[model samples]
Target: MPVRIGGLASGMDIDGIVSDLMKAERTRTDKVTQEKTLLEWTRKAYTDVNKLFAEFILRTRESFGLTDSSSGFLVNQSVRGLKWIRRATVGDVGIADVSARAGAANGANELTVTQLAANWSAASSDGISAAGQSRSNLASQFGLTDEDVVHLTISTGTGTKEQKVQITIENGMASVIKTSYGAGEDGEDSVISLLSGKDISDLSLKELTRQINRADIGVTASYEESIDRFFLQTNQTGAENTVSFSDE
Candidate 1:
């Protein structure tokens, strides 16, 4: 048969066929690089979400008058990676878990931050009771408030005789209010009795967080149990990554 070339069976263009194969290989490589880039972006999105969660937890703890101790829930994730090969879907890199106390003081305490008066000042007289008028007026003039008072218990030495007292405030106003019963069997719960007649007002949740942050409580505010994922928009051609949300 006479030599034939072109139209699918051209053994005449073997080199050209090889060149075309190389071009296809390069195209595949480019696609792989694109997929990798997408994966990295998605991973970063997950990390940012977790960081935000941490910040919120810290802020919440500080607002609740937990300055001496760090409070709030801590979360972590496991098993994060690309789920889909074609569209390049990614999953949370780790297992999601919370860090909270195992018992009693378990959950987050919802409270706001307020300024504690340095002394018996006038500004602290906002809600003074009738019997507290004279003292309240004097405290207001000097810039003291009720929140400054921290109740404590004192022992009388020879026996376990304990007495409840408000040390931070003036000596006589509401200090050393004994909690013992006449029977001498046992004293009233000193802490409870000290706080029985006290009235406390806390800032709203939102305002409390603001105050905590303002005080530089060393903790940031963040959202917890949030969903961090992105969606790919489908079009006539195919699907591609779109906007991503790092929270629930």
Candidate 2:
């Protein structure tokens, strides 16, 4: 005997199947939303990591004459495993000298840089005498107008027991000479203050970094943070890379 199922009975089963499908679709939608949230959370974490690294580096900064409140800080999120980018340094003049002479005093008196160091004491001396006249004037009789920059050396001799070199030509009288062994990079603030006319307080980290990098400071650059780090990097590798901060 053949038993046929009626349309009403089948209808009920079909409705249940439809409902189940709808529920599956909603479940999938929920899963997608959760995944998106996780992604957002990861992004925020990365940003936080970058900020942390930047702050660490800033704190460790050895104060190489930075004045800007926001300078010397940087982060590059795209760079994996603790990478950093630094701005270039410009206006880094290794040597600068301006005296009363326009060109070398004379052919024979030409002072070489190498020899300048040995004769620095004599060159720094000051006395009022004639420049010399008609070749007959005695060398000592004439004013000691001949100044030679034999050499420029830095030393550490500016403590209580230490000594320095100072000279002045005023009122036709010469004072006792003192040699300066350049005090171990101490008193640097005073040196900076002594420089006038230019705003040493206002410096461009970007330009300075560029100059240093070009000079082969061996630094890699990236933007882990929004702004740039205002300095150049050194080429020190492995454990030698102390200037950059770690992401961990």
Candidate 3:
């Protein structure tokens, strides 16, 4: 139902007057809107701080491998020579897991080491592997273009940890930007935020080398202009440190 009120007889601009009156009422809405915006900002700040703290705790845990929990030592099956053949006697001393009580017999044993771990490695296409190569030239060398993607995947610790970084040119800029289109599960801002917004065409080989080194992925990239070659090597030698690449 619509309310009908005519101000014809009084010749009053009722609608205009009401509109003017309503202007003051909008202050409530405006205040609410402002408060809502402030609340959002407060929430964002709290959330960001919380996330940063969470990340700090997680990294600390991973680095030290320590926690507020009970722990025990258990040798894995890989320890071949550690299998106890006989109990240690009271007068024997060797690498043996046994219990010697009052007047109990004791024995001795030997231990041996066998194998070592190795890391995996891979190289990018030699087309873009030249020293002092510009990023703009990379598209043509790798058969990529504007808005295309180049993916680099690094696997560590038998796939327990893996990071994939997706790269693309910024809109209306020749600089680099971190994108989510093909980024690995844990490879967003942390792994590929280096050299952000810097034009690749303008960045020298030495500068690119610096950025790659700063990525903290336990790998180093160096360019040798004298031989027109680029090399990617792992900081640690182990088969678990695998590197792979793709472009689209």
Candidate 4:
């Protein structure tokens, strides 16, 4: 005879009771599985965080290499490691670049970008001097009349502080002469526009230029006949080079 089972003498459903008991056990196993999945996700998050920190440390090391004079600033290897974007520098990419390195000193550095260092320039109101045509009379060539003065004052480290030089014309002529031509001449103004006490008298424009260059005033006055333009500029760059004048 086979083994007698369930609901018989007891009038109870033994199969249904055993099935419900197994389901309760299954619930416990399922809870454990979900917890294990959550733990794996947390481990992945921590791994990603550690990776970010490692990358930051690598960049910091590169920065240090650039700043250390022994390594040489902006070396190709160090700059490449820092990952400098081309956009960090201002102005034309083909012309300029910018970067930084570690420094021994600690102070706030002020970066002022006033209009790029440029020469003081002005165009003649009239086209008196044109390009390709040499004029001996710089006075008329530069649109100068009876009382126009080219006042050039040099206030820079590379020049003399007491320099209040002036270039002028008289009787439609001027030349760089070696003497107090008008420095203290009779009936002359105390400060005649003669450059460095040198008298410039009725000389051809070319000869006059040769003489002016000999003055050693740390400046050059050029007249481009092709463009019919005359310009005066100091021999330097940056804010220190302040060459002031009038377009007279």
Candidate 5:
């Protein structure tokens, strides 16, 4: 330690002067620290803005590419050639409605309908059960037993392009239904388990209809309680659209 001569020789306030100098130094240091913090925040803001601009540029390039086939605005290397508008008119609006794509011909075309297309449909030859009977009664009427295993195959489409869905029935309950495509396709089977673990006796006619519709088998099934018959129809109207059923 050094001996401090406070106003002994100079007779002035030396300690007060030193304290004032230290206060000035502390103020300068605090100002530098504040300036450094402001600079860091400014740098961060610029980085965030640059990131946003980069993303926007990437998306714009993808959507507006001249040669990009997936770009909706470009068609055959010409943006004006893109088909984005079309209009159609029907003579009899009540009979049918018509629509045309933008790529269709611009001139009006006359069409004559000799016969309307019909959807393939079938109904049970006889009543499945008496009127006002519960859906559970169908098991007995169809002669289904808990020990019996019934294999039901439903097919759609025509000729070589047909797709078949097979449903297995056991213990008066239907298992998962799987559909496999025909030749020239992947032949991968898609499985739908709408009736899995469900007892037929516990389901109502409406509930059964809902389950069958959700199966997406290209067929719709309905039960008419008034006529006591089950009806099945193809979901689409065309010559190629057909629905067939075979059970054993």
Candidate 6:
């Protein structure tokens, strides 16, 4: 390119005119570049919208179990089917609550509750200890002797499903008496000592209750200090569930 020296011979602002022309050309080029960038952004937004529509269509087809060859997509065969909007209603909300799933039977179903189940429980008829008596002195109240061995069998369940847990007390300590059955005959009984070497005076009702609960023989034993009595109950609540205590 040849360099042109202006304003030397023309005595006019020739260099300023050429600079203004170049500025106008740069402005036009910048406008074209901005338009191109805006077009690319618009194309990208349309592509994203198309992808979302495609995903929604695929999920709808999969939900209705429709294949590519299916002519139309209708949930449960018909658009206005009652199965699509199946709902359950209870007559008395306070008594019971009901819920219905999609495609459930449309009809009034009756439910009647006759009785409620309850757990079997037994409590001492008379207070074992006097009011305000210390719980640790409960053994003395029972008149337990070192030579005396008290056997208590707690039987649960009915018929052949019956289970027995025999508790034997000696020297104020209670233990689970495990018996072995050999060929339809009663075998030797083994004693699993719970509180060994504990004297009658040293034994507490609270301690005995803890030992019985720890045994996990389907029976819960608790001593009420206020009433001064022992309460025994089965862990489950049903007619078949029973807690029978046999003192032999």
TM-score of each: 0.23, 0.24, 0.37, 0.34, 0.51, 0.50
lDDT for each residue of candidate 1 in 1-248, tens digit (9 for 90 to 100): 89867646854667787999999999999999999999999999999999999889777654542432423544332212212211211233242322332232423433343643221111222332233233223243234466454443322211332322222233313322333323254733533222223222321223322322332212222211112111112111211211111211
Candidate 2 per-residue lDDT, tens place, 1-248, comes to 99978558666676777889999999999999999999999999999999999877766542432223455654332222211232222232343333322222333223345622111111213322234422222223332333511121122221232332222223332222323234346643222111122221232223222323332323432211122222223333343233322111
RMSD of each: 28.6, 27.1, 21.5, 22.1, 7.2, 11.9
Where does candidate 3 have its weakest 10-residue lDDT segment? 74-83
- Candidate 4 lDDT score relative to the true structure: 0.52
The lDDT values for all models are: 0.36, 0.36, 0.53, 0.52, 0.69, 0.69
**How many backbone overlaps does candidate 4 show?**
13
Is 2 or 4 the stronger prediction by lDDT?
4
> Residue-wise lDDT of candidate 6 within 14-63, one digit each (tens)?
87999999999999999999999999999999999999999898777656
Q: Per-residue error at 37 for model 3, in Å? A: 66
Residue-level lDDT of model 3, residues 70-174, one tens digit each, is 345422222223224324543334333444333444545455536655544455455355344344444333334446533444332324555444344543123
List runs of model 3 lying over 4 Å from the truth: 1-118, 122-159, 170-192
Enumerate residue pairs that collide in model 3.
88-106, 88-107, 89-105, 89-106, 89-107, 90-106, 118-238, 118-239, 119-238, 119-239
Tens digits of per-residue lDDT, candidate 5, 34-132, equal 999999999999999999998786666546442454646533345433333566788888678877654678787777778888888889887777544
Candidate 1 Cα misplacement greater than 4 A, ranges:
1-16, 67-248
lDDT tens readout by residue for model 4, 1-248: 79775597788988899999999999999999999999999999999999999878766765654434454553334453443432244455544465544322334444555556665544555555534444655543455555644543332234223223444455443423222223355834233333333323334455555545555455566656555555556666665555544333
| Index of the highest-lDDT prediction | 5
TM-score-based ranking:
5, 6, 3, 4, 2, 1
Task: For candidate 6, report its TM-score.
Answer: 0.50
With a 3 Å backbone cut-off (N, CA, C), the pairs that clash in candidate 5 are: none
